[model samples]
Target: MHDVVVAGAGPVGLFVACELALSGCSVLVLERDRDPRPPLKALPLGLRGLNAGSAETFYRRGLLEATMQASGAEAQEVGADPEAVEAPGPRALSHFAGMTLNAADVDTAALPYRLPSPAMEGFMTSLDAVTSVLTERASALGVEIVRDAPVTAVSQDDEGTVITAGGRQYRSRWLVGCDGGRSAVRRLAGFAFEGTEPLFTGYVAEVVLADPDQLPIGFHLTDSGMYLRTPFPGHLGLMDFDGGTFDRSQPLTREHLQAVLRRVSGVDVTLDEVRLASSFTDRAMQATTYRMGRVLLAGDAAHIHSPLGGQGLNLGVGDAMNLGWKLAATVRATAPDGLLDTYTTERHPVGAAVLDWSRAQVATMNPGPNAPALRKLVHDLMRTTDGTTQVYRQTSGLFAHYDLGDGSTLVGRSAPDFRFEDGTRLGDLLHNGRGVALDFTEGRALDGTAQRWAGRIAYAAGPVRNNLGFTALLIRPDGVVAWDAAHTPDRHAFERAAHQWFGAPSRLTTGAPSL
Candidate 1:
């Protein structure tokens, strides 16, 4: 029996499986799709953005370079100098209701604790690029992936979960549903999915335009709806304020797509052929909770929203990153009390925020007299330095803060990549998928105390290129800082923080001293 059975071989499930297998948990991934490399996941139509947050996650896992190369990202565009001490200003930013923000306008000095790293900006990548990199990593970590195995039934008891897939049954200690919005595991497991309905039906397609010149490129917001034409040939996106009543199950033909294009774009554009097409709505919904006994949900299984703000993929990546390590610890029976529960508590809010962000984008672009005024106001505001910075924080996939209940705001945030005098960075330490104890104290103050956690936490101490005023920090496996010290490091407080997150420390190999 596997330690974990993950549904869907998409990025999230594969990532979670990789995290588990990396930490010594046996993982089996079941994918419903037969083809490993689906055609739609290639190039133009399949293109997606990997926000800086997702970029950081790939960096933490040592997959950033490969994924970047595969996605054709230039080194300098998404990277920073290795010897630098400060993080570069935002290199890229997303849009709000088709209104783009200029990254140059962001006030970088206002953002604190950011240090230089190779991955400082969001990387534009495709689903295939991401999955290829993750699949290779998952394979290296000994994760077994079974294709064409759709999870049809799920049953769980106090001991383990039974998953019926591909006409067979498998037993596992835990089950994670990483499937898409129409997740079978979530439905079969009976998790409550609740959220606001959609406002419009959105269409994305690759078509052979007979009169392409009639429609210009880039985001075009009309009185009817919004339509985006990418620089890539034949790529088109449409947001029709049709109350999301279009039956998405129907195949999108040339006739139907041309009508949508004409109505939304207000251009008499003719489509000769529709190569590939898919429809979505801003229908936002999230599982009430992320876990149900032995069965847990991650990625789209947990929450789903429109791609307008381009937060869907990034949010799923965040879910995998947040849940992977905790679920691994739970499978190993090394988790602290209520560690798994924190996944829902922490990620649910982030998901909800993304959903609302999507809904707001729809409202801002909806066909109404107030929309033009709202667009004008939002456009003017987004052109400001402060507005650009706020938008960057909201959409860059960085700056995710969990309320760890610590009074200090620094504790619950993502740790900056602290560079040691020896040239190692925090991202380098996290490549092994273990929590790290970074002690900037000159005398190795945390060296002795950190050993109590031993294999559960890796310890590093020394002078850093820039400590950002932190003397020491305890970072969770997911790179969230559980504790930090501004003054001389305290052993008791460090121990308490470690215990709170990593459970009780093990007896020191040199023989644990009596408390």
Candidate 2:
């Protein structure tokens, strides 16, 4: 039996597969579609932004350059100067309800624990680019990906789960659902999906406009609704306050799109032909819990929200990053007590926050007498330094704080990419998919203490270029700071933290404890 059977072949599922396989767990990925590279995946043609946090995740896996290349992004645009002592202010910015922010307004000094690294700022890329890169990596890691296999039923016992997909039965120790918003696994597994209903129906389409100049480019909020026109020819995004009554299951007729477009844009726009189209609602929902017996959920399967603020892709990526190692450890029989449960405890809040963020934007953009006033106030606020910083913190995919309980300012946050004197970086050390105990003590304070966890954790002793007032720190395989020795190298505290996350150090004979 395989260690894990992952549902969905999208970025999250493939990424989880890669992570499990990296740690020596056999992973089988079942995809619902026959061809993974469907052209429609590139719909909404504009590049999807991978926030700094996601970029760092890619860097940890040594896939940053490949991802950037696939996305047609420049190496210089994706990160800061390698030899710099401090991180630069973010250069990329995200929009809230089509109202964009200026990156220059972000207050860099207010941000904490940021160190100069190759992956600093967010960049624009398509889903196709991301999926292709992950698929190649998953293949190299020996992950089995079977396409045209939609999961039909799921049954689990104390030992493992029997997944019925593609008219075949497969058994695995664990199962992870990374399917999209309408997740079959989620339905079959009987998880509660609860959320607020949408107030409007949103549409994105590529059409043949007879007179494109009739409507100027950029976001236009009308008395009726909101419509956005990108610089790309024929690209259009529309939001109509229809209370989400449009039948999404039915084919998107050109007449209906034109009528909705006219209602929202307040312009008599003519659509000669609609080459492609898709519909969505601001209806945000999330699974009450991520786990059900030996089966679990990740990505959209666990939480789903509108594509507003473009958090869907990034959020799913974060879920995969956080869940991958823990699940791998569980499959290997090396996970600490209750390690698997932490996946939902940590990620659920993040997902909820994103859903609320999306809802907030929708609220502001909702067409009504109060909308103009709301949008004006928000626009004014967003122009300020603090507001810009908050937006950057909210959307950049970095700055997510998982309360690891003790509340050390740095613990539970993404570890800084500490650089060694000889030029090796923490990102370099993390490429092997193992916990890292980076010690900057003069006498190697953590040397012997970290040795007991030898195979489970890689021990590195040296003064980094920027320790950020830390003498030593333990980073989980997912690059999250589990503990840090700020005042002194406290062996006992370090070991306790290690045990909490990495499970009783000592080579963890229970299958190498790769988490």
Query: Deviation in angstroms for 293 in model 1?
Result: 0.5
Per-model root-mean-square deviation over C-alphas? 2.3, 2.8
Give lDDT: candidate 2, residue 456.
74
* Candidate number achieving the greatest TM-score relative to the actual structure: 1
lDDT, each prediction: 0.89, 0.87
Candidate 1 has its poorest 10 consecutive residues by lDDT at: 506-515
Instruction: Give stretches of model 2 more than 4 Å off.
Output: 43-46, 507-515
lDDT for each residue of candidate 2 in 25-134, tens digit (9 for 90 to 100): 99999999998887667745634778888999999999999989888787447777978999899987888778888999999999989998899977878888899999
lDDT of 1 by residue, 343-405 (tens): 999999999999888888888888887888898988898899998898898998779899999
218 Cα displacement, candidate 2 (Å): 2.0
Model 1 residue 291 distance off true place after TM-score fit, in angstroms? 0.6
Which of the numbered candidates is closest to the native, going by highest lDDT?
A: 1
